[model samples]
Target: MRFLETDEHDDPILSVVNLVDLFLVVIAVLMIVIVSNPLNPFSDKSVVVIENPGQADMRMLVKDGEELREYESSGEIGEGEGIKAGVAYRLADGRMVYVPEAPAGGASGGAASADGAAQ
Candidate 1:
């Protein structure tokens, strides 16, 4: 009779142990996921990182109204004044696709001449 009573009480303790084990497993999995997430606080900023990648050189420029900005391969950003808004992207194939700006008149004409001479 005494042994039967002890076994009955052991069931409650065993249940508690199983519950703790289950929670431990859950916490471990959550920690793994947090560490592996790309947006985790410990991760680096999400910028284009080029490894020993191919020679696919590219250039991107952004403009806001009359202001133009250039982004270089060495990660240098430059700003300059321009006419109408436009964006220029130089692809790896050596093709420069740019948005048309406002009609040229004064400074633009000289700039165009200089650019053509340089090429």
Candidate 2:
């Protein structure tokens, strides 16, 4: 039949089908990006994201459970209510080590060094 022999390129429905396929590919890619994002709302895992690290205009986004919180720095050294719980010192090789203070009454029995030796 002549219809069977006609050029498919002249058919408008073929173009629509191709357009739909292109849209489907675009939608799939967008979904993948959204799902892979650490801040996705549907995800249950807690996530912390820092922006502009070490810069004055730094910001932080913390996501816990279903809640999200944002913090912006004022570019000054942070001063807050917190107690000194540990000490850190740089070694000769430039590596830093931390030593936590023993709890009151020596609840931990003794302080352990980085090499697990009692101090």
Candidate 3:
């Protein structure tokens, strides 16, 4: 009579199956979180993350077209191909206002404006 009373809860294999199922659920949740992030590697839009922003010797991580590059600041200005097309002023309210420099050429000014905001 006592042997006949053993039921589903008495099976040790069921406990192992439950543990595996819990692990699978946790793994699925982690995968979803990783893919949904804005800066995820699988995302299409490129992202640039600045390390120690506003510091002269900071570093940068640039992602473009599935490629990644790291740039470190040397605390000195570097030569680059671009025009200074705007001046940004931080207002009292902690907001920035960018005033576009006068157009020097036909398309150069437009390109600078588009890229300046990214910095």
Candidate 4:
């Protein structure tokens, strides 16, 4: 504690203090980079998802401005005018399934016609 000066300029402690300050600045910069990264877990873009992976089993048909029909898993997809109805699904065991043909008349009439046709 002598007054005003001894030659303390050669001390090793000053270099160590400078090294500690540099490390503090590097850690602060790294924290800012981590917070700003686009792929961070809290980012908004990570939330939305898509569920389906393959062709859909159902569809809707629209004609003019009208929704003309809805289709289902029964292989009954609607055919547009030039398009003929075709067999659609093959099961995993290799059997083909097709939409059933519409009855020529109502059910009772079709039954009677079938009996007549068989005779």
Highest-scoring model, lDDT: 2
The true-versus-predicted C-alpha distance at residue 56 of model 3, in Å, is 5.0
Worst 10 residues of 3 by lDDT: 110-119
Model 3: colliding residue pairs: none
User: Tens digits of per-residue lDDT for model 3 on 11-55?
Assistant: 999999999999999999999999987568888788888889879
Residue 18 lDDT in candidate 3: 96
lDDT of 4 by residue, 50-80 (tens): 2232346544332322223333444556666
Q: Give the CA lDDT, 0 to 100, for residue 25 in model 4.
A: 100
- Decide which is better by lDDT, 1 or 2: 2
* Residue lDDT tens for model 1, 1-119: 76556665557888899899999999999999998754455654453333333343555444434444555465446688856665565757776655445565734322222134322
**Model 4 lDDT-worst window of ten:** 110-119
| Among all candidates shown, the one with the greatest TM-score | 2
Q: What are the C-alpha RMSDs, in order, of all predicted structures?
A: 14.1, 4.4, 7.9, 17.0
Off by over 4 Å in 2: 1-5, 80-87, 93-111
Clashes of 2: 0
Better of 2 and 3 by TM-score: 2
Candidate 3: Cα lDDT at 110: 30
What clash count goes with each model?
A: 0, 0, 0, 0
